[model samples]
Target chain A: MMRAVILAAPSVDALDNPALSALLGLIVITLIMTLGVMFATWYERKAVARMQQRLGPMRVGPWGLLQPIADTLKLVSKEGVRPASADRIAWDLSLAAIFVPAFLVLVAIPFTADWFVSPMDLSLLYILAVGGLSFIGFLLAGWGSDNKYALLGGMRAAAQLISYEIPMILSMLAVVMVVGSADVYRIILYQDVVPLIVWQPLAFIIFLTATIAELERQPFDIPTGESEVAGGVFIEYSGIRWSLFQLTGYVNMYAYSLLGAFVFLGGWEWPFGTDIGWGYQLLLTMVKMALFIVFFLWVRTSFPRLRVDQLMSYAWKVLLPFALAQIFLNGLVLVYDLPDVVLLATSGGGALALCWLVYSVVRVKPRQPLRMVGNVPATAPGSVSG
Target chain B: MPFEALLENYLAVFLATIVGTILVATALIGTRILAPYSKDRAKVTSYECGMVPIGRTRAQIHVRYYLFAILFLIFDVEAIFLFPWAVNVAQASHSAFWAMVLFIGILAAGLGYAWRKGVLQWNR
Candidate 1:
């Protein structure tokens, strides 16, 4: 009777050994990702400097490869200044709250076959959901600091993230519709034969644009536009607290690159059906990620900052509609037997055309330059418009 | 299970204990290295708009932020539950899907209720 009871209860040993291993593996991956973030900062500085025709950080170690390490040591040694009005507990907790979840998201990313920490069926959704948790940290930092600038920055980030999230998720849904699974591995496997980018090109474009905004990267970096807000939400943070935030940003950039590779660029899958070994596959994945990172840096150096309203409008009005249409088109393609290339090309072309039409209609006409609000005309003090 | 099996089963606990001890030691050392011992009137002054604060800086915030936080918690919990329900849907009968649809419908109704009540409204 006891044996039957034990059997019915589902033995704890039945939980599977691989599950435990996966959890440990995920922790290791997260650690590696954290290191990746530190390196990416160095990479970005060097890359951006190269674009500007200048030598970046070449003082610390060979070619300044250890610049991030030096930066981290300096930040660690510096004192963390807390505003007297600040909620100390909340401020301290906010750093952990932000950094931990960003680390946790790495677990859902697969590096190779049999390499994922937790093989979740809903890995993609899980990553998306957890990624939103960073906003809470931002809010906490803003509110906890009791500084108006920080508060405004935090609020802007929250609004920006929440707004971009809709289009981002919708774009991902287009991939899901094509692949019929939210599992990261499955999505990659589906991409093996033909990458989802081919079928969901519109979704790919929308996803890339929204993700750039989500990461608060160039063109969409109005939140941290130093000239306007004086460093935004991070103006108050100093020393290690500021370093942690910066670290989180770099890690998020890497995470986004990995996500792009998985969703659109056939993660760990070599082009032209070359069955590369696992080591080579990892190298390929890194190369693909580097290319995406370069693209990010390139855009940062190339484009001017987007106005807040324009950024929001692009996400909501432009990306969201096209993402929805792409999903619908994907559904139709799935239901019928059509030439895959033709279907994809037509859907992509249609989305682009629609976007162009909307763009033309909504394109802002250049207006007369505004007179400075406080500038008094030299000829007449009352003539504000002169 | 025998005592040996029980001991084997608890291997993870042993590993965690070792890791936890190392982490605690490192944290203590880090705190010692980083903490500043100096304190003075100027150092302790309340920071308020780059001026000495006139009144207590720790005033109570708006109650609506708390209300919204509570609402966020409720919805977050609902989302967490949906995960397991979603994973188990394939194992269940067709009724499971209908049941989920009904459940989600009710949740949506709650969201709508909150929206109508202005609980979800953020603007001051």
Candidate 2:
């Protein structure tokens, strides 16, 4: 069954027609993933609306199934505007920069054992390196736009992403430590009995939170905060260029979801010692990916946006310390020959405890009313202030 | 596969592609420069949304942006170093992990100092 699925993919036998096969595979995957992204958008709107007691996209296509498609068409047909002050070449390059790496990142992700295009030993590193490249694209988009808002958005995004990357990489290190290898396939294979989530719970939580921030998802989505920065780095983009940014965003969402599946949920692995066929394995993978996407949307709706300072502090102060502690604990577990389940439970509990402790410590206290020098009032009676 | 072999295969391909793209871009720019020799009064004039040229093509920008950029570079460069160190952590001695812990400890201290100094605060 696995062999058949592998053989069914056009890319599998494309060693004979390398270029043509690669192009075809690219098109197919792009279309499928695009559809997945479109559905994900609709799903998010509906889910969030339900959570908030409202209806979303009901008028589009049967509960807004076609809304994303409609939105895409509208965006494509819209007029593209270039500012007089903008750098045209960099502006165009920014779109390609943001998107190309996202496309390549998908290549390294394995949907199932045989379903992977080519299993490389360095898949995890490849993903991380490619993921980091998107920041260049984002930074260019902001700087090249020559708009204050765009520049601010881009800078904020750069700072946030660069800051959070520390805890994010550290969290992944915890996983790599337990798995004993950086290879995605080997990691999955190690999870044949129990997933890494069992042993590296803290790492899983930190990784997921940081990944969402890396993807610029909300509560950490100050980069594109509409109210504060007017759509952030994307404010200057229009027409197909804007669509490219949107497309990259959706692709990143899918890629992050797939990453979460591979690391924590145990890629293509069935729970409870059951051995399913290839078809069921593929289905299970999709289900896991969908569950992750829902998790992304759920968190977005449940939390308000974090202030920029708060976001940075959370990454550096909160997540970083806990990631360090978790790594230390994992080392202890390995040295002591503890059961995998025990290690997983204790690591996860430790992470949560550390987070709560950090949260309490970092909780901001209300500032005392500003004191005035001498007898002067802090503010005049009719004066307006922030 | 051995580590050396894997590195040779992937890194060689990656570097070759990057070099190829650079060569192609350079060739395109050279062709445009060597092929054209036309200059008109209109060509010398600045184009600003089809309006008359403004005072200057460049102006002073806010120093805050440069400050942020510098900070970003420092942290980004630090993050890059962590990647390889992380990959080799398993093979290294126990001292390596502790060294990393201390390294991160120093960086975290910097972050804390910046927070106290209001560098990370946005509203101000």
Candidate 3:
């Protein structure tokens, strides 16, 4: 019975024709990802709201489960007002520029043991390369909007995204170095005895930090900070167009979460040792991915947005050096045929050093309390104080 | 056959791109059909928190952004070069490892120079 399901799974050659299989696999994964992102928005709101001791989205459905659907309906019916000053073509085309790459990254992601839309030799590299293309969309939105806020936001988004991309790629490169394969499945298979995170804890930590920054969640969400450039590159987009930007954001979040799960958490091959069918493999993938998403939401709720200067410095000065160091360490071990235990020691020490560096920088002197000046008179007479 | 397999892999991505284009087009058309449109001058005016817009939108941005872009290009290209080397490191000879270290060291020196020049400083 299990053999039948495994045989029927959507691997590279599930159907008679490869084209047909590709089409069918894309549709299934697309639908699942869309629903997953929808559920994610509702979950993020509820989770973050609960963290702040507030009940969120109580109305749309049971526990506001249908809120994302309602949001889609509302956004779909809202007017897409283009600014008269905007570049009409680029403004409209930027949506496709951003949204398509988010979906393209899903092409190589394996949800189960044999259920990927495409299995490439360098699927890991493909995902990263495709994922980087969305920065162009942000830049286009900023340039085309003809709004000051949007322009400011767009440049910020591009800078932040590109700055974070280096460390993220390098961290993944460290993993690839260890496994000696950039293929996602092979990387997972190598983790049969122990997950890569145990061997490369520094890379794991750097990847997590960089992923948060890449996803533009709080602390790193300087581009879209409500207190600053309004909605940033999305300041001019309204209605379905605006909602598409938001949808891309959530989709990217899910993509990164899934990537992190497969890369560091041993994907479905850990503990269970890859003998289980696709059903359990899929379950393991979802559980690990959910852990990543929840951590993102928790960080989003708990952290304050970093200053723009601090954000850039953190990427260049802090994360980049550590990431390069991770690569060097991995190379050292692999070159000399060193024992795996050496990796745990060197990387674990590197992780500790990274933590210390961040902690030392973050531990600044507290600001003095505000000293209010006494005015001639209070605006409200009874509310006046000395 | 191997080449065909490679094309099949990319075929999935191509199909996804087509689907995405169709999805965006459908959303645009669906909004045109379902959403309301009113011709108000105020609505079309470039949004600036309900105030009369003062200057052109594409004014001079900070020069720092340009510097960062150039830096990003250098590092990004370096990273691309590292990927294939990284995957092949285990099978390669010890000399291969030293070669990478030299390559990275030179780049790191460049980075150090940039750092000293205050290129990484945002506010300064």
Candidate 4:
């Protein structure tokens, strides 16, 4: 009985009591997300500023470490002006609807082998499902604002989000098929010998594109494109509400980066194996996550915003078919009991094909202007009226 | 039990939601306390790049968005069916693979038809 108790204790999680674990996990994760988002804001500004050849926020604590805090303080103290005609309930609910899920996804993320708010069997699915709900908040914000720009931005945001979600889920489906598990922990463990990126480069590429689109970052940021919509859905928000939305965006960046790290980059498993202590596990996870974040920031500073039409077309036409093809290939291999090298060959070929497709599309006649240029008669054939 | 473990895991998520709500509520209240507020009619009116607003805020959207939404609904459901098949594909037989191939083939066929119809074309 004593030996049995010892073995059982090992099976139980560190914080075995559910209620206490929930409370403690919530507090720790909340604090981390808040501080991490603040740091991310500072990091992004500094990174983007450097890329543009300018010093960013040098006045605050050494190297402008305190800039995000100062910005937060200013935003918090500024008046939150709600438009008189805005829908009360929708506008109010949008804030929490967007903000909470950004924080809630942390509950299932395994920071290390043993360190997690909860070790879930279906963590990947849970995160995807929870993350998808935030688009509803965007719709509500857009409809409730009683502003045309907000409504336009909201519709684009909703449409863009739903479109990109398909490719993201499909890419994840490819990974799940290869690993035979939807549990993120097991998926990471499967990569102990070899990371999935080698076997499913196509899926990795698809996931990367979908991640950028879903985040609504540069190139895919039509919903909030400053030049076009002038702050889009966020146009009518001010003060704390505005800051919260911005904060949620950063938090989501962190969340998706972490997800990418765990799924594609092998999380805390590869290179060092599972025997490493918690400190190394934590280090590995953070470093991989930082790689993703930097790539995101780099992409943000580099790419021009894609046209809405191009964005939607690419997701549905190009990415979706490729993603589905990846699943089919994986199924074919798995059922045939083929060696792993076959996966690399097939997926690598698909990646090349995808690249060629993009290159060929670009090489073709430049995309027609949405309408004929200035001085075209409104009634002229093939001319569009705004 | 498996069910018990599942409940324990999700209980944390539930608590996280509640805690998140409290945290956001506190921030809202804190902002209310810290921020200065004096309402003005012009300030409350909808923003129109400094112009007095013109017409209805809720205008009719294009029909294409609704059409794309219907397309999305169909594809999303297809994706849902694919997930379980994906998880068990390794142990499953060749017949299962062929079944999925047929299912996805039909999806691709529909997508191709949409493309041919110019439903995927945004400008149209």
TM-score of each: 0.74, 0.77, 0.93, 0.92
Task: Pull out the clashing pairs in model 2.
Answer: A198-A344, A199-A344
Q: Report, for all candidates in order, the number of backbone clashes.
A: 0, 2, 0, 0
Q: Is candidate 2 or candidate 4 better by DockQ?
A: 4
Off by over 4 Å in 4: A1-14, A363-386, B1-3
**Chain A TM-score by candidate, in order:** 0.86, 0.86, 0.91, 0.90
What's model 4's overall lDDT?
A: 0.89
lDDT of 3 at B108: 87
DockQ score for model 4: 0.79
What digit string (tens of lDDT, one per residue) describes model 2 on residues B1-124?
Answer: 6866665425433433343334334433443444333545543333223455556433455554465556556655665666566555656666776776687678768866876876655456
lDDT of 1 by residue, B26-117 (tens): 53346448845455666544343566756543345556546545544554565455545443443445565456557656765675676677
- List pairs with backbone clashes in candidate 4: none
Give me the runs in candidate 3 sitting further than 4 Å from their true place: A1-14, A364-386
Q: Write the per-residue lDDT of candidate 3 for residues B1-124, one digit (tens) a residue.
A: 9878778779888889999899989999999999999988899888778976897889898999998888889989998999999999999999989999999999888989999999999998
DockQ of each: 0.11, 0.13, 0.82, 0.79
For model 1 the local lDDT of residue A341 reads 76
Error of 4 at B121 (Å): 1.0
How do the residues A1-386 of candidate 1 rate in per-residue lDDT, one tens digit apiece?
A: 64465466645533455435544664576468657878889989999999999999999999999999888777777766677768877776677667766766776677876566555657788788878778878878877887666776776677677667766776776677566677888888777677777777777778788789989998888777787666777877777678778877888888888899888998886363436767777787888888789999999999898777666556545565565456445544554444677668866796678668657755655654555657853342333210
Q: How many steric overlaps does candidate 4 have?
A: 0
* Each prediction's fraction of true contacts recovered: 0.05, 0.08, 0.82, 0.84
Q: What local lDDT score does residue A150 receive in model 3, on the 0 to 100 scale? A: 90
Between candidates 2 and 3, the DockQ winner: 3
Interface RMSD (Å) of candidate 1: 6.9
